[model samples]
Target: MIWDNNFAVSIFPILLQGLWVTVQITLLGTLLAAVLGLVFAVLRRLAIPVLSQVVSFLVVFVRGTPLLVQAYVAFFVLPAYGVSFNALTTGIVVIGVNYSAYMAEVYRSGIQGVPKGQWEAATALSLPGVRTWGRIILPQAIRTVVPMLGNYLIQMFKDSAVLSAITVVELMATAQAIGSSSFRYIEPLTLAALLFLAVSYPASRLVNRLERRYAPQH
Candidate 1:
């Protein structure tokens, strides 16, 4: 009764469009995180002089800071320095960079878990360094970490709500806009919750299934 039927109906389409933007940000951000994370993981394993140390410091800094602050810095503060980006791009970069640090740790553990014997075998066979990693080490490490990476993807999806703070007009932002304009919080906020649950729940189940399927076979 607080919102007229017409207003509620009209807002649904707007929210759905906003949801599409959220999905796009999550997908692109996850892709970037996955690639950057793997690169960092491999670099950490290589322990290449100062580059490894710098990357290690960066990973710690990103993982330590709050993501909302990062979003604000990327969207608001960067613009003052003549580094302007649209809301969606800012959201993607912030989330991707933040999660990449966490994913890098997950990947590092996976790579380290590979038996030393495997590396020794590659060396004994006179395999080139790149071929050894690409053919032997990376495949096993990736299988171990895929589930964790998928979980990070889900986490990024949920965290996309934070982008609302930067005026990204994602699902939560759209909900807030509709609620503020119409003075009805229940329907729009409730709908956003349901939409997030609908996506996240299934994605989580898929992650579990992947973990079970790809788990180390002893």
Candidate 2:
């Protein structure tokens, strides 16, 4: 056997503790991403002169950059300006912003998918702008994109491992620490992969089910 029984038992609890940190960050990060992504989508849709252009530039820049670099800047660089965030807070914010860029695309597609006739009718009725979105546009758009947003949430959960670079001690960090110190790479790493697969596979299946449920069929 590549890993013996006693070693597996010893490491499981430690990994679980780290996994809890991962779960907390993933939940917070996904929430932040969902809200910020929709904000970006809405701002671009408004086409509000210079503001829209700036939002567009920000979205493009975030989507173009590497997330790990963003994490570094959030963790290491921000402190130089006296804008310090602890490792956990930094990880959550960085991951949230990184995923928000992709989520913005999903939100844009969903908003665009709404029937043009719906938009026209809202305008024709002289509906207040915020009321139009709140009553008509966002409801339909958000429903259409729920499954896609869930997929990003799953991706963000996996990506949370990257936070270990900033020393957040998530699941991957726990595995690496154990492996390096004990010289048993296989068990801790294997355990971490199993934990991820166990959660992500079921979540993916749930997304598929949501797509099937929500997809508009002729």
- Name the best candidate (by lDDT): 2
Q: Model 1 misses residue 157 by how many Å?
A: 0.7
Model 1: colliding residue pairs: none
Please write out the lDDT profile of model 1 over residues 70-160, one tens digit for every residue.
Answer: 9988987999999998888888999999999998999898888899999999999999999999999999988898888889888988999
Q: Which sections of candidate 1 miss by over 4 Å?
A: 1-7
Error of 1 at 6 (Å): 5.8
- Note the Cα lDDT for every prediction shown: 0.90, 0.91
TM-score of each: 0.94, 0.96
TM-score, prediction 1? 0.94
lDDT of 2 by residue, 52-146 (tens): 99999999999999899999999888999999878999899999999888888888988898899999999999999999999998988888788
Clashing pairs in model 2?
none
